[model samples]
Target: MAAPEPATATATSSPRPSMRWRVVDIVIASVLGVAGGLVFVLWNLAYNPVTAPLEAFLPGLQALFHGVWLFPGVLVALIVRKPGAALYGEIVAASASVLISGTEWGPLTLLSGLVQGLGAELVLAILLYKAWGLVPAIVAGAGAGVGMVVLDLIVWYPGAAVEFAMIYAVSGILSGAVFAGLGSWLIMRGLARTGALSRFAAGRELGSRAES
Candidate 1:
C-alpha cells in the first residue's frame, strides 16, 4: 500500500478531542463559571481597597488584579476542552456576577466577557485546540489581557494619558499571564491529583502518572 501523507499520519496519531459539548461538559463548565462569578463578586467588593495602593503608587497599576476576571475562560477551556467553552464559561460567569451583585459596568460586563473569551478562544483555535500546556495557558491569558485593556481604554479609561494607558496594558498583560495562566494550570493540576477530573482528559493524564 502507498504511504499515508504526513499530515494524515500525524492527525491519526495525535487526534484532537471532540469539540462538541456534552452534558457533563456543560454542567462542569457552569459550575466553574458560577464559582468564578462568586469570586468575582468578592473581588468587586475588594477591588477598590485592594488596588488602592497600586493606583496610588502608580496609575493603571490597579489593573494588576484583572487576571481574576480572566481565569474563568482559561479554566473552563482547560477543563472542558471544547470549542466555545471559553466563551460560554466567561459569559455565564459574567452573567452570574451581574445577576448577583451588579458590577459598575452594568450590562457592559457581558460585552467585556465576550471580548475576553474571544481572546482566549482565538488562541486555542489557532492551535487547533490541541495544546493544553503552561505556554499556551500563558499565551491565552496574555491574549485575554490585551482584550481587556482594549475594552477598558474605550469604555473606562477613555482619554487616559498615553503613559498611563501603556502602564495599564503592561500591568494587565503581566497579571493575566501570571495569575490567570499559572493559576488555572495549577488548579487543574490540583483537581487531577484529587481525581476530581477523572472523567476529563486532564484528569486521565494524571491518572496514568499515579498508576505508573
Candidate 2:
C-alpha cells in the first residue's frame, strides 16, 4: 500500500494568519473603536442616572461600570489581532467619552483607559498574539479587571474597605469576562460566520469547523 500522508504535513498545509496589515484591518479597527467610543459615551450618560441609587445603597456598585469602557478594546484587539489594538481602541473610546460627556475626573479617565487597555493587551502579548481561545480571553478580561482595581485603589478609592475592595475587584473581573472577553469572542464568531474574516485566524477556525 502507498504510504499515508503525514498528519503534520497536512496540518502545516492549513492557512495561517499573516503578519501584514491590510487596509481593511485598519478601517475595521477604526470603525470598531469609534463604535466602542460611542457606546462608552452612552454608558457614561446612562451610568449616573442608573447607578446613582446603587451608589447610594452600596458604594462598591460603582465598579460595575468600570469594565464598560473596556469591551471595545478587547473587541478591536481580537478582530485586528495586532499589538496596540486594545490601547488604540480604548483611548479612542475615552476620547469620545470626553468629547461627548465632560467628567469631573478630567484627563484621569484617559489615563485609566490606557492602563486598563494595556492590562488586556499584555495577556494577548503573552499568548504571542496567536490564540484567541477562551482561556486567553478570560485571562485578558481578568487582567483588565485587575488593572481597574489597582488603578481605583490608588487613585479613586484610596480609603476603601477590604470588603468593598473585594466586591469591586470581583465585579470588575466578571464584567470583563462578560463584556470584554466573551463579548469580543462572540463578535469574532459572528464576523467569521459572515465570511468577513476570511483572512484572519477567526475566519480560518470557523471555516475549518464548517468544513468538518
Pick the lDDT winner. Answer: 1
Instruction: Flag regions of model 2 displaced more than 4 Å.
Output: 1-16, 102-106
TM per prediction:
0.91, 0.83
- Scored by lDDT, model 2 comes in at 0.80
Pairs of residues at least 3 apart in sequence or in different chains that clash in candidate 1: none
Model 2, 14-61: lDDT tens per residue? Answer: 576675677887887778877887888788778788778877888787
Query: Which numbered prediction scores highest in TM-score against the true structure?
Result: 1
Instruction: List the RMSD of every prediction in angstroms.
Output: 3.8, 3.6
Give the alpha carbon lDDT tens digit for every residue of 1-212 in model 1: 99867787676686657788899999999999999889889988889999999999999999999989999999999999998988888888888999898667767999999998888888889988999998998988888888888999999999999999999999999888877788888998998898889899999988898889
**In candidate 1, how many clashes are counted?**
0
Q: Which TM-score value belongs to model 2?
A: 0.83
Q: After the best TM-score superposition of candidate 1, give how far the Cα of residue 77 lies from its true spot, in angstroms.
A: 0.2
Candidate 1 wrongly placed segments (more than 4 Å): 1-16
Which residue window of length 10 is worst by lDDT in model 1? 8-17
